[model samples]
Target: MKVVIFSTCVVDLEFPNVGKAMVEVLERFGCDCYLPSDQICCGQPTYNSGYEKGTQRTFRNQVDALLSVESDYIVGPAGSCVAMLREYPELLKDDPEYLGKARILAAKTYEFSQFLWRILGVENAGAELNGKATYHRSCHMTRLLGEAESPYALLEHVKGLEMVPLANAHDCCGFGGTFSAKEPEISKQMVDEKVRHIEETGAEILVSCDPGCLMNIGGRFNRLGKPIKIMHLAEVLNSNVDERRITYLKQMPV
Candidate 1:
């Protein structure tokens, strides 16, 4: 399968290793991956800040960039950004020039874990991590993107990883893109509560599918002098992989 990597702004600028892990995992599953240099931010920061009209160009640019290469799918590491990409058709519906193109782009885009479990039928990526870790369900990944199971499903098969059930796993991690910047005090309080729950789990590692949440919760743990390690879902799945244990539900199509 020909796949294009949708490296979100945060992954490109801040968490580059997450993007690398995503590509590595996809390539391991027999995908021919391509990273288009023309790709940019998915416009969530500006769009969520009530600049809908101003984000139109960004929406169009992303559609053009991802489609620049002929591919079967566009996969991104961040569920929050992939959810934003899935919104392009509606966001650009009035644009006669790009509306159809936006629809096509949205249809092919999938979040990393979602693609692994759903499209690729990967039940196990042969990853092994020795520690108790709790998962933070990002607001956009669950509520907005409606992907509540894909990450957990894949995580279940990781050898030696003990997945702890986070208390109030549905709560937001207080990293709503621009919401964190505009309401830092409130955001801090929300993330503080999230960290408390994580600490309650007695988990040595905190895992989340969204980089924004990891940044928020991990930053709080750092400032508070807690020793929790933060990891993205892709990083967790790509770690200590055992080639002999890697198994898929079905074979890749020819």
Candidate 2:
């Protein structure tokens, strides 16, 4: 099947390797994957901040970029961005020209975990990792995208891996994109609480599907000298016992 890698803006900028790791996992499954270089932000921040007009440009660009390749699926690593992509139909409903294309793009888009566990029927990508890891359920991935179970299902199949339940796994990491910047104090408090819970789990690593959350919580941990390693789900899934063990050790704050 033809798959388009819709690596969102954050992964493109800060964690480019995560996007590559995602492609690595996809290729392992024997799928032809193409990275759409011209793709930009899904206009989520602008749309969330009540700037509808600004969303149109990014929306149009993304629609044209993804639809240009007649692929079977457009898969992304971030749930929030994919959720925004899914909203394009409503965002452009009044504009008859792009409305149908928006819906088609929305229908074809799939979050990484959702595609792996649900669509691709891949519970195990034959990856192996030795760690007690906990997953932080990004709000958009769980509540908005309704993909609460796929990540866990995939994690369960990883050889030599131990998945633990995160306390208050559903709580927000206070990195609601602009929310962290707008309300630094509140965001700090929220992420601090999140870090505390993560520590309580006693897991060597904290895994999340969203880059924003990982950056926010990981930044707080870094400033406070917390040693916990923060990682993207794709990175973990693309790893083996030797690679993952070294990763955990290397990421430990010195």
Candidate 3:
């Protein structure tokens, strides 16, 4: 199957490797993936900030970029961006010119995990990771996009990987884009609490799909000198199976 990848701003800017990993995973599954250069932000930040009118230009450009590419699916690693992309239909519902285009794009767009497990019926992408890890059910990916089980479904198949339940798994990571910047004190408190819960899991690594959430929690881990490793879900899914076997043998507890 051919696919057009929507490299979300966070993965494009802060974690380019996440984008690369996503491409690797998709290709491993026999997907012909294309990353269009014209794609821009899905206009999530401005729209979420209550500036729907201000988001029009970016929204239109992204809609065009996404629809112009002929592919079976338009998938992205970030659930937050996918959630926003799926919203374009509603955002342009009243505009007769763009409404049809928006709906077309939304119909084909999907989050990476959702695309892998739900759409493709993939149990595993042959990933290997041997470690106790906890998944942060990212707010946009879970509550907003209503994809709570897909990531876990994919993770469960990783050889030698133990998945732990995060304490208060449903709580927001406090990285609601501008929310963290606008309310520093509250954001800090919320992230701190989140990190504390991650620590409670006793997992060696924290895995999540949204780069924004990883950035928020990873930033606190750095400042507080915490030892938990933050990993993108894509990276883990695309891990080398040989190295994973080695890790499983060496790291498995007696």
Best candidate according to lDDT: 1
lDDT of 1: 0.91
Task: Report model 3's TM-score to 2 decimal places.
Answer: 0.93
lDDT for model 2, on a 0 to 1 scale?
A: 0.84
Residue pairs in candidate 1 whose N, alpha carbon or C atoms collide under 3 angstroms: none
Maximum-TM-score candidate: 1
**Shift in Å, residue 181, candidate 2:** 0.8
Candidate 1 lDDT tens digits, 144-172:
79999889988999898999999998888
Arranged by TM-score with the best first, the candidates are 1, 3, 2
Each model's TM-score?
A: 0.97, 0.92, 0.93
How accurate locally is residue 98 in candidate 1, as Cα lDDT from 0 to 100? 98
Q: Report residue 236 deviation for candidate 2 (angstroms).
A: 1.1
- The weakest ten consecutive residues by lDDT in model 3 span 245-254
lDDT, residue 86, model 3 = 91
- Against the reference, the lDDT scores of all candidates come to 0.91, 0.84, 0.87
**Candidate 2 worst ten-residue window by lDDT:** 245-254
Better of 2 and 3 by lDDT: 3
